[model samples]
Target: MSVEIKISLNKGLYLKEPQDSKLGRKMIKHSIMLIEKFGFEAFTFKKLAKEINSTEASIYRYFENKHLLLLFLVNWYWEWVSYLITMNTMNVIDPKLKLKIIIHSFVAAHKENPNVEYVNESKLHNIVISEGMKAYHTKDVDSENSKGFFKSYKNLTTSVSKVISEVNPDFKYPYALATNLFEMSNNSIYFAQHLPKLTDISLKENKVVEVEDMLLYFTNKLLKK
Candidate 1:
């Protein structure tokens, strides 16, 4: 069964909400495909407009620039993962178990969800792994942060951090650990696939059990103390 998910993101990220119109949605759908195919630096409004059968001016109507468009996609991804965590951990009372489920959700969220026909979660996950940091690692990040542009990512971290606190109230670095686990899930997979020397896990075909096991191992070891 496929359910429609509507994720509300920061208004500052776009001049117009891309989800509200067919052309806007087409712009987003192709933006992801273009970015994933050519990488972010090579992606441009001109190319996107050509690919989507729209004009550069039309693309500009939806987004101020390509950077903001990237941020919008990245923020959407963070919210999706957060939603998955909620769904996966629902009614699970054990904090340790909930944390375990979070690890699974982090890994599993990379898989495609049929519900969101426009956004390919798998390709978006790859984009997040490779190009996500560019969204905030900029001189303008502080100004953007002031406008709540990064709230979706922060909210995802906070939610996981709360579960970490529940598992061990005395754990002093819940937020750090929470964010690290999520980053590690993405990083380790990227490393295994492209830079195998950096990670101990070996990449296999369409499976990430090693990444899940490694995250669970670390979480258990850290929280057991």
Candidate 2:
């Protein structure tokens, strides 16, 4: 299947929809690069504005703060991931195979998308590994949750949990497993690259292959009757 370049994001993620305007698109595109380059702590609207040759005030018109911008970017990524999972597993009837396909698609998501010019999937994956959780780890998490700020992520988890149920109706931890599957996909990569001591996988080797193997092994081992 062809890679989709554009996906509609939740309105709650942004003060103004970046995908709606040329400058907004530049803000989103440059912000991804800047966040990946400097990490979320050092990334700012002023830095982003300089990178995009726009004013910080213009950027603020779209996002109330840098935290919200990160939320928007990270949520956009999760929605894309949710789409990829659905498209790839739609035709597969076997629950085990569907789970395997989900794992593989996630490993592949660490790579760049040639068709999507506005955002780099690979860089976005790094941001997710490093800073994605901060989006929800705020004092306003309850308020954001009430606003459906995490709907895309929850939808993805729910989708994966359904496959877990199909694989083993008696499994008591489908939601836990589903959410771990999502985090492990990125966390494993992060550990492999930055904290090799935390993981058995090595960055010198094909990290994606190692992560896929490890995920499949644990998943199959856990799900097997």
Predicted candidate 1 versus true structure: per-residue lDDT over 1-225, tens digit per residue: 567988889999999999999998898889999999999999999999999888999999999999999999999999999998888789999998999889998988877484867899988988998898899999999999999999999999999999999989999999999989989998998899889999999867858999999999999989885
Question: Ten consecutive residues with minimal summed lDDT in candidate 1?
Answer: 108-117
**Per-residue lDDT of 48-129 in model 2, one digit per residue for the tens?**
9899888999998999999889989889888888878887888999999999988887777766464767888888888998
How well does each candidate superpose onto the true structure, as a TM-score?
Answer: 0.97, 0.95
What lDDT does candidate 1 reach at residue 97? 90
Indicate the residue-level lDDT of 33 in model 1.
95
Q: Which stretches of candidate 2 lie above 4 Å from their native place?
A: 1-5, 112-114
Candidate 1 deviant stretches above 4 angstroms: 112-114
Q: Tell me the deviation in Å of residue 36 in model 2.
A: 0.3
Model 2 is weakest, by summed lDDT over 10 consecutive residues, at: 108-117
lDDT of 1: 0.91
